[model samples]
Each structure stands twice: as C-alpha cells, then as structure tokens.
Target: MDVLVLIGRVLFVVLFATSAVNHLTRSKAMAGYTASRGIPFATAAVLASGVVLGAGAVSVAVGLWADLGALLLAAFCFSAAVLMHGFWAEKDPQAKMAEQSHFFKDLALGGAALVIFAFFAYAGHDLGLMVTGPALSLG
Candidate 1:
C-alpha cells in the first residue's frame, strides 16, 4: 500500500511538473491557447496555473501537505479540461483527440485527489477543515 501510494504521488508530481514547465516556458503559446478557449486574462491565468501546478507537484513529491496539493492540482486540471478543452470543438481530429485525452486524464487525476484527501482526512492530517461534519458522512 505504501509503495502504491508513493507511486501514485510520484506520477501526479511528474505530470504536473511537466505541465508547469510547459506553461512557464511557453507562456505566449499557452496564453494564446487559453484565450482561444474563452478564458479571460489568458496570460495571468497561465501564470497562476503554472504556479499552482509547480507548487502542487513539489509538495506532493516531498510528501508535505500532499492532500492539499492534490486538491489544488485536481482543481487546475479539471478547470483546464472542462473550460479549455470543450468537447463541442471536435472538428479537427487531432484537436478532438487531445481534448478527449486531457479530459479523461483530468478525471483520473480528480479521482486520485479524492483518494489522497480521504487518506489525509482519515489519518487526522491537518488538511484544512471539514465544515459539513465528518469527511465521509454517509447520511
């Protein structure tokens, strides 16, 4: 179980690290791409996303506040997948494939984030606060 958790964390870190590097290095292209997706303040958005991605990756890799890192990374990925990669624009085969791939990847990442969150919550880790009661309230 430890090995599996470590592997999952490493994978998430690697994925986000690569994305962060891309966003940081290719700011103009990323900004343009984001703008094309109807996101306002594309440049600022890319920069902010890059910061979150990089920070999340580092935190997860170091096993420091990993749950929160996973949550933030999941949010970034979900937003990018849904807002940037709209399914309606499937005219280009390549674009369609990329968009679909990102969408599924983000979905998987979100699941991973949930798993991490559950682990931290159950282990009594200081991961923010549960405002609505127990983390896993069945009722």
Candidate 2:
C-alpha cells in the first residue's frame, strides 16, 4: 500500500514536473502563447509558474509539505483553465472544442489537487508518507 501510494504520488506529479521543464526550457514559445492569452509579463509569468510547479512536484513527491504543494498546484490549474484555456473566447468551432477540453482537464486536475490537500492537511493521516509537514489545519 505504501509503495502504491508512492507510485500514485509520483504519477500525479509527472504532468506538472514535465510541464515545468517545458516552461523553463521553452520559455520563449510558451511566453508567446501566454501573451496571446493576454497575460502580462508573459515570460516572467511562465518562469514563475515553472518554479511553482517544480516546487509543488518535489514537495508532493516527497510527501513533505504536500498540502502546500497541492494548494499551489490547484491554484496553477484553476488559473490556467480560466486565463489560458478560455474556450468561450475561441472563434472557431474546432478551437473552441479543444480549448473546452483543455479547460475541463485543468479544472479536473485542480479539483484533484484540492482533494489531495484536504486529505493530507485536514485528515491528519500519515500513511505511506516519507515525511510530513505542519498541516494546513483549516479548522
């Protein structure tokens, strides 16, 4: 079970980790797309988002401060869904469908991250964890 949980954690972070790499390595292209979405300081935003993603990936993978990591991921996902994948802004039907799909995907990812945050931060469970941090403790 521990091993399975560990695998799950790693799997969950793979997309974020890889996307972070892309954001860092392909900043110019990514920035151009981000700029098209009307994001201010697109390059800086891309780089900063990459950093956030990297940090979140590491934190979640190691189960250290995972709640914080999950929160960061959730924020990134939700923001990207709204700011980057705005399907309603698309003029072409195909583009709108693609954007709508991406928008939903981001929303789902954000929702999953929030679930992770709640599980670790509020449930007070340490099963299958290497190390834990001060939980978010919203209550």
Candidate 3:
C-alpha cells in the first residue's frame, strides 16, 4: 500500500510537472495565449505560476512538505480554471466545450489536491517515504 501510494503521488504530479516545464520553456508562447485571454502581466504571471507549480510538484513527489504542496497545487488549479479556462466567456460552441472541459478538469484536480491537503494536514498519515510530519497544522 505504501508503495502504491508513492506511485500514485508520483503519477499525479506528472502532469503538473510537465506543465511547469512547458510554462518555463515556452513562456513566450504561453504568455501570448495568456494575454489573448486578457490576463495582465501575462509573461510574469506565466513565469510565476511555473515556479509555483514546479515547486509544488517536487514537494508532493518527494513527500516533503506535501501539505503545503497540495495547497499550492490547489491554488494554481483553481486560479487557472477561473482565469484561463473561462468557458462562460467563450462564444463558439466548440471552443466553449473545450474550455468547459478544461475548466472542469482543473476544478477536479484542485478538489483532489484539497483532499490530499486534508489528509496530510489533519489526518497525519504517512506512506512510503512521506515525511512523518506535515508542514501545516490546520485542523
């Protein structure tokens, strides 16, 4: 079970880690798209989000300060859903559907991150090499 949990944690963070890499490596292109969505300081925002997400992914994967990592992941997911994948703002049916899918995906990821946060922050469980203590104590 511990091994499985470890695997799950690593797998879960893959998407986010990959996205973080893209945000850093392709910042200019991503910033253009972000700006097209009317995000202010799109370039800086992309770089900042990349750093946040990369740090969160590393924290979770290594089971170090995972509670804090979960919070960071949740924040990024929720903010991106609202700020980037605004389905309601789309006009074309296909585009709306695409945005809606992305919006829901981010929401689901955010929800899962919150659940992980609760487990580490409150339940105080450990799996595999997970740190024995949580970085947060919000019960």
Candidate 4:
C-alpha cells in the first residue's frame, strides 16, 4: 500500500510537472487556444494555468499539502476537460480524437485526485479550505 501510494504520487507529480512546463513554455499557443475558447484574457489565463500546474506539481512532489494540491489539480483537469476539450469534440476528426483522449485522461486524473483527497481527509488533512472556492484568485 505504501509503495502504491508512492508510485501514485510520483505519477501525479510527473503529469503535473510536464503540464506546467508545457503551459509555461508554450504560453503563446496556450493563450491563443484560450482566446479561441472565448476566454476573456488569454495571457492571464495561460499564466494562471501554469501557476496551478506548477503549484500542484510541487505540492505532490513534496508530499506537503498534497490533498489541497490534488483538489486544485482536479479543478484544473475538470475545467480543461469540460470547457476546452468539450468544445473541440465535434469539430474535426483528429481534433475530436485528441480532445476525447484528453477528456478521458483528465477524468482519470480527477478521479485519482479525489482518491488522494479522500485519503488525506481520512488521515485528518484539512480539505475544507482546499476546496472552498477558485484555485486561483486573480483579484
């Protein structure tokens, strides 16, 4: 069980780290994508996404406040799957496949995050504060 948890944590870290790097390095593309999706502020949106991904990666990697990290990541994946991926699902075949693949992947990640959140909750991790509102508040 311990080994499994470690492996799961590692996997989560790797996933979020890769995503963070991608969002950071490809800010222009990401911003354009967000704009295409009708997001009001593309640059701000990309930066915010990068921050969430980075914070989640760090939290999961360090195993310090991982439940909050997981919840934040869950929100990220959920929004990406529902808003971004869902919008592309029926437009183009290749795009649709990619979006669907991402949708399922995010769904799986969200499930894993929930599991981690549940574990932490049972272990007395304070999750009430983690999920109170938006993961990032620009204001």
| Cα lDDT, model 3, residue 113 | 92
lDDT of 3 at 44: 95
**Structural similarity to truth (TM-score) of each candidate:** 0.78, 0.93, 0.94, 0.79
Give the runs in model 3 whose Cα sits over 4 Å from its true position: none
RMSD of 1: 5.3
Please give the lDDT score for candidate 3: 0.90
Clash pairs (backbone) in predicted model 1: none
Ranking by TM-score: 3, 2, 4, 1
lDDT of candidate 2 over 1-139, digit per residue (tens): 7787779889999999999999999999999999999999999999999999998898888988888999999999999999999999899999999999999999999999998888768653656565885357753
TM-score of 1: 0.78
Q: Can you write out model 4's per-residue Cα lDDT over 1-139, one digit (the tens) per residue?
A: 5456657677767978888998888988889888887787888888899999899877765566766787888889898888777835477888788889988998998888877766664652323323232232223
Local distance difference test, each candidate: 0.74, 0.89, 0.90, 0.74
lDDT of 2 at 10: 93
Which 10 consecutive positions of candidate 1 have the poorest summed lDDT? 130-139
Query: Candidate 3, residue 39: CA error in Å?
Result: 0.9
- Residue-level lDDT tens digits of model 1 in 36-63: 8899999999989999999878767666
Candidate 2, residue 5: Cα displacement in angstroms equals 1.6
Candidate 3 lDDT over 1-139, as tens digits, reads 7777679889999999999999999999999989988999999999999999999998888888888998999999999999999999999999999999999999999999999888778754544578655788766
Clashes of 1: 0
Instruction: Between candidates 3 and 4, name the one with more favorable lDDT.
Output: 3
Clashing pairs in 4: none
